[model samples]
Target: MVGATEEARLNQLETQVDNGGGEAWEYLCLVRKLKARRSEKVLRHGIFILNSHIARSKLGGEEWTLYEQVAVAAMDCHRNDIANDCIEALSKKFPGSIRVGRLKGMLLEAKGAWPDAEKIYAQLLVDNPLDQIILKRKVAIAKAQGNLAAAVEYLNNYLETFMADHDAWRELAELYISIQMYKQAAFCYEELILSQPTIPLYHLAYADVLYTMGGLENLQAAKKYYASTINLTGGKNTRALYGICLSSVAINQLTKGRNKDEKDSADLQPLAAEALLKDYKERAPEKLALVTAMLRNIKLVS
Candidate 1:
């Protein structure tokens, strides 16, 4: 296999593999055929043939080149275990090569080997503490595992150095809601909506928190939020609660007249309840729709 005849025959095949040809795969198939026949001489000579060809190519000049080819060949053949093994061997040979670890970790994670991916990513972080990819992956794992507290903490740490991010704000706010921390969630969404004022769902969330406050004034705010939700949804989601949000605002505005400074403190509990259940229902939804439509019309006209 090491003789002049084998070398001369593989001379052209080696050139093909070195040039990133489909022939590289074909050449490997030939090697496998020889191996299955227990021809170690052919296998050894074939590797040397390929290596000599690679010697003239850019990637082959490096020690990692053949290992890369091995990994690629294994992966191309759908031999994931073989590919992963090759990756491990290459990583050991190239000790601390982030690139190898990254590819292997991704493959393991896709295979549902969470612990393996975690281990690889953790090592990458130690070596490159501020690695953005690692940081994002860490946060994603935390979120996927339903560890919202950890997700929040991780995001907060990240945002300390990277602030005013709209997506992060919304994600944390939704997480807060998932835990039923409506007040905190509302505040977070309020900030996001205030900055990106065109998003109505955030306004709807803010209004929901106000409804939970149980006052006519808060009800007015809640009505505005519901109106915004309707405008945004085009009357889709929150349609069921739309009436409630609108009525709360009507009762609040009627009793307290948007006066955040004043509460309807009188024991007019019977009157408030009657107005809320009976009177507010009679007109608020229609009025809110009319008001919202008019606002839209005005915006369009202007």
Candidate 2:
């Protein structure tokens, strides 16, 4: 986040704490929260708050959720320089504590610094082999970097390590769709559905790939999936499910080249396309539009 000098200063503070040190972060916490300048004096409190959270986080040989929260706060407040500086400094100060590496990695990954994030995560894995959190982060980095084979491999490992890994299966399914490996993606969704079918997005995602690959025969299955998803999701997310259903219906129309409305074949395509776009927008915040567009493109105009 910050340049060399600030990172060094933060490291020094953490080192003092590590060596049977002081309540520096606490003392600064009481400082005046007045001006918003980058001076060492003003930034010290922020640094202290950041480190205090980190110190509290390192109590056990465990995951440091508090430090993760602190780092996230720094990033969310556009204080990445402070967060990064804090992370780098703490790593040196508390070399025995994996909290520094883990929290820093979490912050970096959240901010889209996948390469650097992956490096930190790799270090954490070496320290704690059974850390499901780091394993998930590794899968995420592989998936985002388009290393689908790697993602698939790591997820398989995650399964062996964690039996109750519902989210891991969900992420695996999503990655399959991301790489356009529809059939495999569908299977992944099916596996997750076995555990948690109530999430509407999972059903929608499953229906999408089925529709993409199976043509007309798949439409019936897709519709069925959408219906189940609707029932499971309930009215709380009704609009979102409706949006996904509309997109699925639009895809079916493309494959069939006509709607259930037998009256106008030529007029159907553009209308279907428009409905797909509308539903996608109404789906609260998701990548349904991108998925819809991709499905729309894999067609034969004949």
**What shift in Å separates residue 209 of candidate 1 from its native position after superposition?**
4.4
- TM values, all candidates: 0.46, 0.53
Could you tell me the TM-score of candidate 1?
0.46
What does candidate 1's lDDT look like per residue over 1-302, in tens digits? 24566554455565665665435444544555443332332333334544565532644444355555555555444557756765777878778677787767766655667788889898898878877657766777787677888887887777676557777777777777777777777778777887888776677667777776546666656666766775676555434244443454457456545554335422222222333334334656656445445334423211
Q: How well does candidate 2 match the true structure, expressed as C-alpha RMSD?
A: 12.5
lDDT of each: 0.60, 0.61
Q: What value of lDDT does candidate 2 attain over all alpha carbons?
A: 0.61
Number of the predicted model whose lDDT against the real structure is largest: 2
The residue-by-residue lDDT of candidate 2 on 120-174, one tens digit each, is 8777788698987788878878777778889888997898778567777777777
